[model samples]
Target: MRSMTRRNRLMAAIKYLVCAIMILVIAVPLYISVMGGLKSVGQLRAEPVSLPNPVNWNQYTDMLTGKNGSFWPKLVNSVVIGLGTVGVILIIGTFAGYALARIKFKLNGLIYAYFQLGLLFPLAVAILPLYLQLRSFHLLDSAIGVILPQAAFGLAMMLMLLRGFIKAIPLELEEAAAIDGYSRFGFLFRIVVPLSTPILATVSVLTLVSSWNNFFTPLLVFNSEKKYTLPMGVMNFMGEHAADWNLILAYLTLAMIPAVIIYVLCQKYIVAGLTGGAIKG
Candidate 1:
């Protein structure tokens, strides 16, 4: 028993050390980006790793106020595209998930399998065909171009998550609602939706982050600089401000803020939704 206790303590210490290393790996780059943004060009160039002695606040403000290259416009574009993708995913994924979870049909398994195949593939594999398809449709360079493909790629995961969570809902609750004169659509909208809040929040947060950070699709689709999203904006900013490391850092820092805020706010739901979905599925 004493030997076992000693082994457990040693394992615990190893786990803690691994966790601390991982945190440092992630946090150090973020710390540099944020603190470097607050320094002047001379200070940042002189001491790249050091903290800002007296933080300069103007760079962030200037970037926000459009002194930088189309910063606000790019930010707004990202917001619109991200929200649009989320809306589309939720609408499509929820209905599909509901059907797969509740309704018994001949092709149900086949349909689920088709979507599940998407999980085995990444978007990079389809970018060429996707780009060609968008070009053929004249959707290239439009927000719809970005939105449609993103929604398509995100749909499978969202459906799986929703389906898993929906399956966990007791069948009796749905039956009880049905006996109470609730129509299928009504029951879905009123009962299933409310009960699936954590998963919905999870999907929303994930979709928002993925859409916002998406660079490859946008890079391929958007021709004009004005239609660029935040990630694209950062690239353009880097090019334009190549000499000014401080301003570049500031832009990068500002670009990261919204996603961080969103994740922080919805992190609890993210954890609950992921765990719940896994267990239920």
Candidate 2:
């Protein structure tokens, strides 16, 4: 009994130590970015790790207030692209998920497998083909260019998550609705969708973060500075503000806030969605 107790205590200590290490790994970078942004360029150079003596708010406020038409426009572009990608993925993924999970049909397994194949491949491999397709369609340098490819790449994961979640729904509920004369669409919208809120939130948060932080795709697609998304804009900003570490950190910090806010708010749903979606469809 004493040996077992000692072993459990050792295991618990190890787990706590691991958790603390992970927290430090994540928190240290965020602390540097925030505090670095609050310092002046000279102060950042001199006392890189020390807290700001006289906090400099201008780096953030100046950009937000349109001092140079840099940060806000890029933020807006990110919002538009992120929302557009989410909209397309949700509309298409939900129906596809429902059909794959609930409706019995020929080639359903094949079709589902086709989407699953997408998960096996990374988008980088197909960038050349995707870029050519976009160019052919005259979609280059447009939000549509970014949105379509992002949605296509993201669809597979979203569908899988939603399908697993939908399959977990009680079939008796669908039959009960059918007995009440509910149409398929009605049952889906009223019943399945409402019940799949956690998964939906999961997909939304994931899509938003992916779209918001997307750099390579936007860099390849958007040729014009005016249409540059936040990630692209931040890169360009970094180039211009290369000498000013504080300003660069400020841009990076602001660019990260929205996605961070979203994840923080939907963290509970993320956990639930991931766990629930792990069940086989």
Model 1 Cα lDDT, one tens digit per residue, 1-281? 99999999999999999999999999999999999889999898888889897889888888778776677899899999999999999998899999999899999999999998888889999989999999999999999999999999988888888887798999999999999999999999999999998789888888888899999989989999999999998998888888998888888888888888987888886676667656755
Candidate 1's displacement at residue 6, Å, is: 11
Candidate 1 versus the native: TM-score?
0.88
Model 2 RMSD in angstroms: 2.7
Model 1, CA-based lDDT: 0.90
Q: How well does each candidate superpose onto the true structure, as a TM-score?
A: 0.88, 0.89
The RMSD (Cα, Å) of candidate 1 is 2.9
Q: Please, what is the whole-model Cα lDDT of each candidate in the order they appear?
A: 0.90, 0.89
Best by TM-score: 2
> Residue by residue across 1-281, what tens digits does model 2's lDDT show?
99999999999999999999999999889988998988998898898888997999988888788894388889899999999999999999999999999999999999999999888889999999889999999999999999999999998889888887799999999999999999999999999999988789888988888898888789889999999999888889888877888888888898889878977887886666556555543
Which parts of model 1 have CA positions greater than 4 angstroms off? 1-23, 53-55, 273-281
Alpha-carbon RMSD of each model? 2.9, 2.7
Candidate 2 stretches with Cα past 4 Å from truth are 1-22, 273-281
Worst 10 residues of 2 by lDDT: 272-281
